[model samples]
Target: MSRLYGDPIEVWTRDGEPTQFVWHDRLYLVRRVLDHWVVAREWWKTSEGDPGERRFWRVEASPGREVGSYELRFDTAGSGWLLMRAWD
Candidate 1:
């Protein structure tokens, strides 16, 4: 199972791929990208706002300990990035 935080994070990317992200005051380096996909906005779910497409990444990351997988989402409408879930 994964926990959802929806917290905004700062990410560093290389060649259009995420390499690292800052969360909970720690830097987690992405060791591997497990998967990636795009989620289109659900128009019915938004009555007042729409953010377009959201890109997600399932990655294995490490912060000087045992590596763990995480899910991240990037909002294309300028809402920035979010650390959606994490497997610890």
Candidate 2:
């Protein structure tokens, strides 16, 4: 099972893919990308030519220890990266 969180985090990306991220004062390096996909964003919000989509990445990461699974979301509105869910 996984727990949900909407905490904002700083993520470093290379070639449009996440390489590392910091959350709760700890840094996690992405070991592998488990999955990647996009979904439509909130329907209540609308903008010109905006498809309203949310970019998501499920990754296996580690903070210098055993790996864990994480779900991350990229805020399209420019708020930044968010730690959407985690499985320890």
Candidate 3:
């Protein structure tokens, strides 16, 4: 899929679990926390270090009734945030 520039997103954790996320540029609040998870993978093809990994946070929101997750990639090269996955 193609993404526009300057998209807004959020990342959070549930019950002290790893971080998760919801994607949106508009301001909003979490009416209630549902669930959260994390995803980490090695990017050997794009990595240039001993351990090049990407981290993601999957979260379920209530009010919006949206499901998906946020991403946080950490590698010897760099780190950044992204919208990993989403569903209705």
Candidate 4:
């Protein structure tokens, strides 16, 4: 099963890559980055040179012994991190 989330998370990065994140008061360490990508949409319609793109990292992470798949999003415009999804 997969769950979607829009909750803000505190993330720590190394080499501009997500290394750890805290969500719901739980700390999860990134074990591996499964994928990394960017999404930009309707760029021609937006103003201020904003491409409306979001940086995403799909990773395998764990707060404890059990590792889970997580998708983290970085909002370039706001410089905020969000927990986008989780897989169980």
Candidate 5:
């Protein structure tokens, strides 16, 4: 897995599942969802911050002909999405 860190991305979802994502000016279609989970905010990290909950998805996708695995995160507080990592 490689870190994309917190790179923001545009995603297309259906029935709450990520169907595709646009990253770095390219679009990748999700072929499979390897895993999905939620992480609670670490309230202890900042006394005045409410980072909110995060939902994560590990998926397999194809940008072209080759399929690869990637991880994406959704911030519930702001409804923002991030590409967390890619296993290439």
Candidate 6:
């Protein structure tokens, strides 16, 4: 099992597939920080534009980790890069 030593993060995907993520315009390799079970589906929204079931993960790296306490969204129906939640 991979351990998180420095920072905490959250990542999302569709069907739990491995994907490449970019941070600060640089690409970083990503893997599940824990197990295959991470993400939680949105239960508050029932509209057509709401997000569906999402897989979550904690991506880690050096000082500047690619992802930080942010929620990522991957939709098979969209184009371009996936969307990432803002860091507070």
Query: Model 3, 7-38: lDDT tens per residue?
Result: 33454545643344444554333443344344
lDDT per residue for candidate 6 within 1-88, as digits (tens), equals 2322322223323455544455455545554343233344464654555545554333432224544343344443232233344333
Candidate 4 residues lying further than 4 Å off, grouped into runs, are: 44-49
Give candidate 3's error at residue 24 in angstroms: 4.5
| Candidate closer to the true structure by TM-score (higher is better), 5 or 6 | 5
Better of 4 and 5 by lDDT: 4
User: Each model's TM-score?
Assistant: 0.85, 0.86, 0.40, 0.89, 0.86, 0.38
Best by TM-score: 4
Residue 75 displacement in candidate 3 (angstroms): 6.0
Mind giving the per-residue lDDT tens digits that candidate 5 earns over 1-88? Answer: 4766678999999999999999899999999999999998887764558768899999999889999999999988778999999887
Q: Model 6 off-target regions past 4 Å?
A: 1-16, 38-44, 49-51, 62-88
Models, CA RMSD each: 2.1, 2.1, 5.8, 1.6, 2.0, 8.2
Tens digits of per-residue lDDT for model 4 on 23-84?
89999999999999998756676676676678999999999999999999998877899999
- Checking candidate 5 for backbone clashes, the offending pairs are none
For model 1, name the residue pairs that clash. Answer: none
Error of 6 at 84 (Å): 6.5
lDDT of 1: 0.89
The per-model lDDT (C-alpha) reads 0.89, 0.89, 0.41, 0.93, 0.90, 0.40
Model 2 Cα lDDT, one tens digit per residue, 1-88: 8999999999999998899999999999999999999888665676655646679999999889889999999967664789999996
Tell me model 2's lDDT, rounded to 2 decimals: 0.89
| 2 or 5, greater by lDDT | 5
lDDT of 1 at 13: 87
